[model samples]
Target: MRYRHLAAASLLALPLVAFAQTAPAPAPAPAAPPAPADVPLIARTQATVPQPVLGPVDQALRVTPATNAKGGKIHMLPATLETTQWGWFDNAQPPVLTVKSGDSIALETMMHAHNQVVPGTTIEQIKKTRTDYPGRGPHSLTGPIFIDGAEPGDVLKVTLNKIVPRSYATNFNVPGMFGEFPKEFPDGQVKYFYLDLVKMETEFLPGVFIPVKPFPGTLGVARAEPGRYSSVPPGKYAGNLDINEFTEGASIYIPVFVKGALLWTGDSHAGQGNGEINLTAMESAFRELNVTVEVIKGQKLEWPRIETKTHWITIGYDRDLNIAYDLLQKETVKYLVETKKAPDEAAATKLMVTNWDCRISEVVNVVKGTYCMTAKTAGKPVAKLPTAETATAFVTVGTDADLNKAMDTASMAMINLLVEKKGLTRLDSYGLVSAAGDCRVGPPAGATKTVVCQTPKSLWRTKTASK
Candidate 1:
């Protein structure tokens, strides 16, 4: 959500201590020197758009890809202050690096709210940075990379090859910038964590270990619009999506907007729950993140979609959960219909209802998100929502915002309930709810919609001893 424009002096009055940072030290040397003015920045160029081979309209517009134009060149873009854009995405921003389609980039990304939150950084410093650049997102995105021959009506296929996270991470909950349960936690709290790469897991809370699954929290091409846009809320351009599914080996197809399809990424995370209920995940930096970019012509898409080895994920975003869910469903139907897998919309809807699992992406991103996952091959459907159990404890908590926010509150409340009633650790509860808890929307009451999530009764069957 776009926050109200605040005068520079107002930042001092706001609380920052509770929502600040401290972390690993960066070397004194300049992260990376900027390209010299005399040096040519464009690594590759295509004077004309490639001719297309017509094909069926599948999930990513089934058009054949242009010949690999990389020519064995890989670009390295470091996350220096000069190369990174703090909190905004503008089509007009100059490209730090440009390359032909089908090239790979070895990129480094900073922590949340941009790279400003390093060790010894103060709350006032973070606030000052915010005031310096008003009306933008807090993420430190690292490019408006220009891809030769990219233009509107084309699809940019981005493949994530490797994502190696830095040793440390941070998570926070700010009071003024409340997440799902606005009233539940009145104060802000920030926590730092050290990750173990060899173990491939983090001891989040004493004995509670969480598997590491790092991904770029935000990545997308420039929007069709001409001016600058806040990188806070995700749109068709795919900014600030915080989708956990974008881990290594996943590919996302984005619709080209302006020519060259200005691409950028930031807001990296090591691990996150499905809802991201607290507004922050394992917000961290990446030491080594590798990605390959390709431009596909003769095909277009209305929304961005992700492809994993096992399933296709269709994403939808809106302030209203119902509307977002509807958009996700329609996108799924469109993909099925275009691919000729379903004879018509009715059949596609049936198949979607039977085979797809709808999931809440995140509710804290100002704009809420919902997505559906359909297996690549036919099989029994997988369930995600919490369900009734034969012998256990179940609890439903209610709060108000959008329908998705209600679900967020329900999720947070259930997590607390699990920790208290089942003797489970907070991390344990969070992991359990994220992977298996189900949330539902109830009829709207007055100005606020009611959302509910419950723990399965079976949770009480086991004795959880917190280490």
Candidate 2:
């Protein structure tokens, strides 16, 4: 696997790798006279330290009560409760804090739940509670500070510093509720696993240890709509986007909704697979996340874009995979054409066909939703063609030809197809053959070849391709 170092521009004020192993000690006592209360907060802090705060929640919100439950009793706080079930608390909104590059943040949390043990409850009950009060259950939430002067059309960069889950827990479906293969097992079965909150440990398998990398499953800002919106589905405002890659050191760009884009983040997870098949992971209560946010003033995006140390990922969620693929293809084509200046459709198609580096990331959630990503950096560039003297005399292939002749014939056939079907000029065809052509034969020995041609820089100097 290829791993690129995080961009220096995105690593705002954050310490290197070893800094996050433990939290920093409290700042030393002030040596001189205490500063005046009237002094501006930003100016005062900026004078002392160049780095800005990355998290909106300050020291004040860190205080939370710790609780646990076993058997069937709400052990510690029975006086205030009507039933044995654990009760939910007020849903705190995520802080709208600005994050600059190189800064890392740490958070502390305690697990609190309303349900101690309710054997007869169904999926409906859990769903109802979650619906009535969001952000009270195991949730993921975190936002980064964007670079100053990032306009609307540009992208806001985020690099995750560290994601550590303090205490963790996983819940299984109750009897007659839900199952992985519901059609095969209708009755439903209940299983639960509890973690040692202090140790921060879990046993996913007999000999495996799953280290926690906490991240908010629903991290986004407010929508463009006037009133408050439910944090269920992701929209233009970027809410409840359950993308799993928002970990430490992974940068994300969200379209700005309002000035300063009040971003709210909550929902931390230990780990999860694509589509979150179970609608949950090893759901945990307490988490610490460090992030940096940069503002992009004018760069507007239709959907959220994420970049890890390795891959560039674009997410498309639609009701149909075909539609999603079409959108993905269009967006990728646009990126290639606009950025690389591939002049015409034929050149672009050749690049896609010859490379085949683009692929479907996942097919899950397609019936209800589809998520797909196309990568630009995964494929090797087409090789430049040989000189005219070495050009293999072109001949069309047919099914009747032998295997070796068929291969050569197929290449010629593709050349012809490019001229007839794609309406390429003779120069265009020749340039394509010389610079960007290759062939691959299938298992049954059928012949196939793809021709690739990149537009000269001068073409884009005059006009650009549009989606």
Candidate 3:
């Protein structure tokens, strides 16, 4: 989210709601001055862009093996994980990582303020980085992973398997970049926070401790457009959504624009309210992101939607709140009709109104969003998950070296991960392809120290001739 202030017109005319599990207001601080803008952005020549290597699955990017808490093997993504290089939601940018649908990803994420705003960082350093850093938008995002067979009008179903905060987080207030009350705190201020991951709490102020619910602030796919778009707002393809419900165990469905559904994610927030209220939160670098992104062919979506194990949620986004509300209504109705084939519109409306509640997903972004949440209790059903299918390629999870060793013999088409083998074994299949693990034998998880192999297949068939 931007921390720069603009003319009064930028302020939300409506009373925005900063939804939270428990909101305890912090004491007031001085009005902060506006944060500085980055230098203007001009498209770079192809020479500046790093052309993808040899093929979709880079042999060189193979990662080493690592152990999960359970001592089973998991993957950490290839060192090629995007942190330094990032792009807008525009389809123009090439995907940094490529995987078939149902592949598991152990992604790493960075804080919004980025390296310049980290602890021990100085204003001078920030100003210096701004000179070279493209100023197209705010937040440091990683991704745009190309999903095989994904194309425009498809929906990417992302399941957040695990999210752990790497170390510290940050919260800042820059003059023009925060809330409408910019004059209240002149000049910007950034604060660092030490996390207690084991305890799963962080101190917001001296007396209050905020529960940590880590989620990427921005999660989106490249838009089909040729021109670059700013990541400062939420869109139909999804970005900077700041939806708090998207924590671990949640599933988000984002619209696909490109053939691979270049999904990008970053702006890690340890905890945040709906409106975000301020410009930042427990913004932090993240480690051990266990996510599975599946492509549901032909399931077109207009806006991004989310679902927790207990609730089915639909989203509506627009610059106009009224328009957002109308869209939300339609989305809810459509969901009901598709899932239940309710007798009539009135019955569907009654079911939604009587059984559901709404949350203002976010109001601070230039494009606001609202979500309709329906409970999934005893008999009530939730969104249908993608049925099991064969995996297109092997998604090897382990440390880089472990994966490399395994690939040496497995010699199958491999997408390596550097991970926490969370739930890697629970799924009988990896969508379309059978998965094996431990880097030595196959692709999923095991405690072995060598390359795991999958059963022999066609050209890409893998072997487990242990070394």
**lDDT (C-alpha, whole model) for all candidates:** 0.69, 0.39, 0.56
- Candidate 2 deviant stretches above 4 angstroms: 1-128, 131-154, 171-202, 205-215, 341-467
**TM-scores for all predictions:** 0.75, 0.49, 0.64
Top-lDDT candidate index: 1
In the range 181-279, model 3's lDDT, one tens digit per residue, is 355434554556778888776654333355677887788887776655656667787787777778999999988877888877777777764434345
Tens digit of per-residue lDDT, candidate 2, span 302-360: 76766777655555444343355455545545555655636866676555445433322
Candidate number of the best TM-score: 1
Judging by TM-score, tell me the better candidate of 1 and 3: 1
Put down candidate 1 lDDT per residue, 317-409, tens digits, no spaces: 886676886688789899999888899999998888767566566776667787777788887656533333324436565666556556756
lDDT of 2 at 236: 44
The deviation in Å at residue 19 for candidate 3 is 35
lDDT value for model 3: 0.56
TM-score computed on alpha carbons, candidate 2: 0.49
Give the Cα error of residue 398 in candidate 2, in Å.
Answer: 33
